[model samples]
Target: MIKKEWILQKALEQFNERGYSEVGVRELARMLEISPGNLSYHFSKKEDILIALLEQFSARNSSFYEHYLTLSPTNAHFLELMEKIFNSQYEYRGVYIGNQYVRTELQSQDRFDYQSIATKRASTFQKIFQGLDAAGQLRVNGEDIAFLVAHITLFGRFWISEATLFTKFPDKNKTIRHYLFLLAKQLSLFATEQGKKSIEEFSRGMS
Candidate 1:
């Protein structure tokens, strides 16, 4: 990879392995075997790197949102979309792991627009819920859909942080399957009869 890309990748590795606050810019340069001056040329401050990493995450999530718009309308497709969401979150575990740190740091800066990030994420899930409801794959009514969307969004966003409290983190596929299974259970509670049938079949196939 190029120098700038390599810096971001290595920085994420450090952030994920340790907490973001525990890693400093000079330490990052040492980890990279480069001069602190070289690192500063790319990212003057540690927060600058964090912001850049978040921008990469935002692009990924936008791509995920756009992919959903092209999917066939079915409960299965919704699950597929959900899997993509989970996969992206796992891929950027450092971001979610440091969700609080990132938010507090960014919130102090006027340029971050932190609320817009949360708003866009909520709107995306709301659209997904509305789509599923219209397709008869979900039982949520108009008012309930908002609550359901918020519920799913909150769970998906913070799940990694919660998972860290476990005695040990499971293997990646096992972790993802467990998450998917839990999500299947959650959706079953509000699924239409047809939706329930679809989710049951999906769950069995997943097993």
Candidate 2:
């Protein structure tokens, strides 16, 4: 039973590392040192495994966002929250990458299930933005709208896979950081003049 759990966990990691289509269920069973029948016993199909992984991802990310929102508004909090966007992208990179490994997994799955997952994942983000808005720290339109803005903040950096990203520095981590800095700089302007002045004063002191 413990070995079975380890195999399941590795399957999730392998799905991410190599993508879903390339990683055959039979091979996964082999790697797990188990019969295909056993894996099928727990998860009837590969699509079933993908759905379970997505569900776990959704719950984990939602809980994380909820915890982050409980923190008071601060530039650091804002930055951390934005970093989460990349982290999420990396976790689900294959979903966005097309005509390849990730695309195959998506095609094998139910479209309605994918749509529902997207909607549910989006709500956690909306709540986090709403928290910031309630504290008068955000300059965005509304929580729902703001969620879209925040998500789009990383548009240039995301990839279905590294191949889809730029060649010079395929890693999007640096690009994501640049966006986070830009976001905090622009959003900090929402503070009162005195608050803004204090920020300037701090910059001067640092200089």
Candidate 3:
């Protein structure tokens, strides 16, 4: 990998393993086995590296949504898409875990608008839910769909932080399964008979 890409990859690993506040540019340089000046050439500050990672995260999410849009809108496909999303969030979990620090650091930056990203995400979920409803898989009305979208978006964004608080040591697979089950349960609340069956099958497959 090129130096800049390599730095971002390793830096993500470090930030995920250790909280964002705990990892500095100097630590990242050491982890990458490069001089501070060399790392600085790519990212002058730690926040710059974080902004890059966030951008990558957003791009990956967009790719997931794009790919999912091409697939048939079945409950199974929806669950699969959600699994991919959860995994991506886990991969870049440091951002969620240390969101307070991240928000403060990037709040003033013009390059990254966290609120706009969140609004777009919620809108995407709303679209998917509407699709499912139209396909006769979900039995939700407009108002309920809006409420459900809010819950799902909020849950997806901050589940990592909740996991850290509730578990002494959160195992990735277990935490993912726990939250995923909750999500499936939420969908099952308004799912059609066929949709419920699909969710049950997906749950069994996970087990």
Best by TM-score: 3
Please identify model 3 stretches exceeding 4 Å from their true place. 166-169
lDDT of 3: 0.84
Question: Candidate 3's residue-wise lDDT over 49-121, tens digit each?
Answer: 8889999998998999989889877787888888888888888888752468777777767778877888888
Taking all chains together, the TM-score of candidate 3 against the true structure is 0.93
| lDDT per model vs. reference | 0.78, 0.58, 0.84
Expressed as tens digits, the lDDT of each residue in 132-172 for candidate 1 is 88888887887888888777877787777766656334466
Residue 82 lDDT, candidate 2, scale 0-100: 53
| RMSD (Cα, Å) of model 1 | 2.0
Cα lDDT tens digits for candidate 2, 87-142: 66565654333326544667665632655655555665566556555666554567
Global lDDT of model 2: 0.58
Candidate 1 vs candidate 2, lDDT winner: 1
Candidate 2 — number of clashing residue pairs? Answer: 1
RMSD of 2: 5.4
